[model samples]
Target: MPGPDYCDVDVLRRIRRRSLAALRADVEPVPPEVFAGFLPGWHEVGRLRGVDGVAAAVETLAGTPVAASALESLVLPARVVDYRPEYLDELTTSGEVVWIGAGASATGLEGWVALVPADAVADLAPDRRVEITELSQPARWILEIFAARPAGVGRFARELAPEVAARAGATAPPLPPPTPAEFAEAIWELAWAGFLSNDSLAPLRARLGGSAHPATLAAPATRATRATRAPRARSGLRSMRARRRIDAPSTTAPHLSGRWSLVPGAGEATARILGRSLALVDRDGVVLRGSVPEGLPGGFGSVYRVLARAEESGQVRRGYFVEGLGAAQFALPEAVERLRAAAAPAPGPPSGLVLAATDPAQAYGAALAWPEACGPGGHRPGRKIGACVALVAGRLVFYLERGGRSLLTFTTEPGVLAIAADALAEAIRAGRLGRITLTTIDGAAALTGAAATAALRGAGFVPHPRGLRLRGAMSRPESVSPAAETTAASGPGAGSGPGSGLESAGGCVDA
Candidate 1:
């Protein structure tokens, strides 16, 4: 682990893996005994009191509010999604609240979202719809415009074309004028691409030729609209739109909404994009080009230079941290600090950590390579949202693919697989993943394999005709499975608890 200010990327990698798993660890913090006894009677019961409350308990939910997914509050942090699931459900699709566009694949604004107050819309509303990214061509062409100027969103591009042409030294005509239909189509592309947007879904509703919201759509086909890729160039605008359904919110909604402005910073557009790139690299702690969206105007070279300058300024550091990520890696100095001090194999048995395969913690396919698949010719598991991964001591142990039908075991070790299986059962019992009905493991029928059966039964899975079924936390009994029943018969310290069955393979942490 000796590596200087930063741990050797090997050690750092292990630390980061565990950190990602713990980023959303399911735990409730409790005060120490000293404070608890010192402040006796501090516990207060009331109707959602503020932090100013005399007791320790405060700012808790006394009731429900609208959310897109019912599990949002129970399982995730606030504002994790731009707006909660279906947050815009009740609002008029064409009124003050609006839907903007999404970034072209991986720009800086992928997960980040913007919101504005109701009255702010009067000043922020687009008079002519913003369409700067495309018209500007190479962003540097009109550096002087975006440099230190918050170009009004409502301003017309036609009005600014002359300055752009003169600045870029272009001898050609100012710009071509498009037919009405062509103009409308171009605007839509920019809107969805997130260069410009408005509060009203009216335009988008018109385009989808039906309900503005995907949830309201009659067909499930459009559910994957965002999966469609729009080309990176302006020339493809017309064909791209005509080629697909272009469902407003489906493809990209719940983006920069309510109120927003273009040209966010007080510097050249390229510089702003570069700075945003640095900010992203800085925020992510450790980042390589693939993880950051700093490749548009100047590509990775620009980002590299900015990071290099930051390195010189002592604002950041550079290294060939992780192998295969190239030498241009940059990380916050504190990240190195954490990398040095953070990880150690815990004293007891390694607990399994279960998170969505796509969760930042499941770095297997991205930061690191996935272990060779156990089954011959078995397709590598995809790191998708619906799929889940189980980890022990920063190493991947299992992958439960979408729909919980296939389980991909990363390890053949009986001990780790048993712990992972018990972790899955704990996840189901906690209602974290709801009921899990897995049909297969390692490409074999779920129940046919001796290893799979022992693991599942140890974790509480019961038989289903198609495969094996485990009830969700809400529907299940106090005990988990036949194995738990046997353990319970042995008395306390055996298997009375939610995750107690893992004792057969050492032990397990409640994932």
Candidate 2:
């Protein structure tokens, strides 16, 4: 048997039939590339899946009514073609087919082709071959130009050819300069590809019709500085125009305000990371205002410092950078008030309790409260200390770690301990920590007591037989009630008793 018919007409007809069958079958429609082998140089004008789809596409292309039956005969294989214009008359007269006319309005065509009746070829020589035209050199040039400076082309909507040519000359493979007509054709192709704006076509067409060469079209005078200065000047002009447009009162719409607000540029990755941390606080509508250390992971410290300085110098940059060391003490206005209320000194003297840190004063305070952990001389052990202080739900929670182990957690208010626990839970969920371990010995018991441990349990923590370890995948409680004030009795270094705890170890304390 003869191999499957690969003739152009047979292939196109099969493509249409299969494509229509796909529509009826509710399967994927055949793509235009399926016909690539049959029509080697022919570019796809449009593809219509079903009879209705075909009719609509043809009518749109022809800009006239297409008989439903004529479209139905094509049967959803409405494979439109772009051929050289020379065959338009022959193809139209010889076919029982839809001829949408050459794509003159769009491509400024050299020729055109159509779906001719298979029988029309009977009179032709058997050996004669139909040559499909490739995209003209100018069209390819235009594509390369668009590919090279997509941003610039988008920015400067008109006068594209020379700018494209000039830019391409700097980097692209050298080719003979295209004529104005060729440039127009290429631009029209680009517009068809949705690269150039449709509105640009009219003026470009007019200019091309008047000019012999693309050079005649008005462009910046070629100079050593033109390449550099022109873009900068254009950018400045564009910026000024944008500003003026913004400043100009909205006369067209009186109800709308003409005032333009400055929106910050795109934020850096560091800003996004910092935002995540801030979001944790912001979600609770809590303000965080204090001097936090610059030790956040992912170089957030440097990002914060840069942003904070920029904010101070009146540079309206993106991200949550405010003035302060590590830019850590920033808060929303509501959070600020909340923090102030939370940190407000009680009527009585300071609660001598203090969270131990590397600082001698704080360590001494901690040692005073818990004499068992301190030496006989009432001096705290000299151990490397790591601390993570976070503001959660309008309260500051401090976690102090000694020798890779969490020592104690101190909170400003009892009500916020749950929020602190939740923060730690979130950290655990993020895989920053394996489990939270809390020991009854050392400063752990003195800082966080039975009441605080209950809060951690409510926040998805399990009291390990050996120590307190948060459950890896515990469901977080919606809300946790404040535990009763748990503080160690005033002792040696206890200058005052502040809220202190032996909260759970591990989890996400060291930021």
Candidate 3:
């Protein structure tokens, strides 16, 4: 008979976890080559890593795609103690694969990123890199400056920092910089825009320099340290104040001054990008067209035909695998098996999980419609940074907005809310939920309703003047300015913001 109807809460939860490799146990480490083979989709580069983004590390190595940090893991001697050198050496050269941004935008941060294998890359008659035509003037100017004189990224950051700063005098300087974490972000954008490319990712695997001091060479960590700390201190590869594009490099930023060379890119690169997107679909097993991300490729429309071909070839199966979407879903035979296998209930009552709202495993906003908002004000959730959803036993309980201050209840069931609250609290206690200080729930005071208060308290939270909070994450006073708060849970916590009390307390803001 046909497989289980395939539209149930258990199937959703299991598939989500399976897609993200968030099963009770951790996924075993796979070589980069093998890992890239099953690459799911481009990860929106930023601090959003848990169960979302491309990857935090390949060791989690499940569905999350490779990231710069993951790339670094394969290189850094300090971090490589866990894996065999040969396993890590798979991509040692620039030839095996190439990392490029989806070219979603020349400015937007949603430049989904991924690494494509060399053979698929070579399939394009011209090339596979995503093409960019909407490049911002500033990014174009910066590219010109660098093109004229290829200097270190640090030097470019330093030069552009002042110019960008002067322009910001008109307003608040747009997205203020000195953000060193974005150094890799800028490289990501440039790579996608076709301004920065190398035959291999070798530049990241090894440090590069020209006329550098012996002391600077001796301390690679020092340069990276300064780069990371520069947003507050002011030095090292600074992100552009305007945010999406960069012009100059900050002083002292080292390791990538002259290593990565510039490239012209293919005239029309959609074929390669589309090919890779389909490749990811096969590897990922089950894929929704929307899951590929908009604007990553230059064009579309041939997906059904391609899937039909694959089906005829016995390469993939097409069916109503997921609920709440059009009937155009496709899955590999193995993916269907795994997804059905995932239908079984977990041995224990679900502990609950808080993962990135955009995490691919979450089918609500992507493959299915978001649950109805239960409270007064209508709530719509997006796959945004710092935004998260809490689930208990595959049921979406609540959605946390970006700042983490406001929350939307997906289910009004008091019992479900209680378990969800407990899960959130447990995650916080274990430091896995990140630091959240809920100010509002269902648009009302998060601690206002009796049920909410009971849920909060039952889950180990305390009634704070702000709303509800866990002592471990919220008790400590914050020192950073309101403007510097970030949304990456793996980063720091929020400090202050625009509202009164908890509203201004940097709700849901990641460090």
Candidate 4:
């Protein structure tokens, strides 16, 4: 059965991920097209024989005996779409007018001959011979030569010369020697056809060097070299421009120098911070390249906003360009610092974070102090918040979090919360927090399922089942006050019980 057709973006991402892994593993896969069949309209040909036919065909056309081996060898490599029904009819007739010959420019004369079966010879024109020439040496040989080697006219010239010379009274045409330029062009053609990836083009480009037309053929490769030497480039380019903006130079500008921030405490620590201007451009580039992460805030609006900022800053002077959305999520502070050091100087770190505005007003308040106060990197200026809510199969699943927690946990499905449970358990063990209480308006099955099972056994945490009454009781309490309440409800209430918005049968627990 055929699989679902994946989107172009997903396919590119999977390919990139797979290729990167293979590189790390020290394995190089053959180009995708080799096994996938890059030759357009080409199909595998299989052999079939009707024994009575060959002897008569050879007698009529080649005027010699036809052996099965010779026929098999000749036709195996050549492609045939269909076999003529009367193929055996004209082959064996006495004075059989078995074949007709014609020449065409595309195939050469070097023309195709039909196998005329002997029994049908009386129906043939008197002057004809069985046209098994189509099945004979020349046609099959030419097809085989072209299929084996795929250089254009040059390949045909070299491979077909001896055969052409061997044909009756024919002098072989002089073979046109391929120039290095021609070879390079062929490489590029193959690359464009997806038979060669950009990674594989490196050595080819190095070989062509300055001779290759349009320096941009290797532009991506050149930028890679420059980026690997980026620290030096960053220093030199910084010394050259100093505080000046390096208006989007090309697709590579983001990788080299876009935004920068000094490492805190580690005097030598450098970070490549992506400023609003660069991030915007890089985001657009990422979309074009199809690497947009799912559930991240900002659609094309984010892109347009970035473009507007670039225009305002006079940063993006070029017509159009593409690049990736440089490492957005960072694990280590040092890595963030490294990124900052590599970045172009910005007025300040980009303030707006990229988050879904699930609870925009509250999330905004959280954003002002986020990352800086709660997470690794300091607070970035631009606040783009994305809420974690996905509509899977028409079910509205909300990813929830309480006040002052970087750990995102929410679930409509029990399996989805497994990662969060493990994380919560680890946090508790490390003394990062006290107790991780999950209060869901769910049935007993959720607590007994794999998520709870793993948490109880693997993480040594206890699972507490909560009742649905808390949800109803909290929703419309007869009397409640803003300041009078001390604890927050576990599920959803202003603030009254557990203080963290989590509620179970034992009472509200800090979510």
Q: Which candidate is the best by TM-score?
A: 3
TM-scores, all candidates, are: 0.48, 0.22, 0.56, 0.20
User: By TM-score, highest first, what's the ranking?
Assistant: 3, 1, 2, 4
Across 244-284, the per-residue lDDT of candidate 3 in tens digits comes to: 34333432244333235444344335455546446646545
Instruction: Order candidates by lDDT, high to low.
Output: 3, 1, 2, 4
Residue 335 error, candidate 4, Å: 15
Q: What is the lDDT of candidate 1?
A: 0.43
Worst window of 10 by summed lDDT in candidate 1: 58-67
RMSD of 2: 33.7
Task: Give lDDT per model, in order.
Answer: 0.43, 0.31, 0.46, 0.26
Residue-wise lDDT of candidate 1 within 413-486, one digit each (tens)?
88877888887787666655555555566766666657656777778787554456676656635344676444
Better of 2 and 4 by TM-score: 2
Name the runs in model 2 displaced over 4 angstroms: 1-387, 400-404, 440-448, 471-511
State the weakest 10-residue window (summed lDDT) of model 3.
208-217
Q: Candidate 4's residue-wise lDDT over 407-505, tens digit each?
A: 222232454334434433443332222233433312222233344334333434433232111111112222334322222222233222354333321
Off by over 4 Å in 3: 1-194, 197-220, 224-249, 254-274, 296-300, 429-434, 471-507
Question: Scored by Cα lDDT, where does model 3 land?
Answer: 0.46
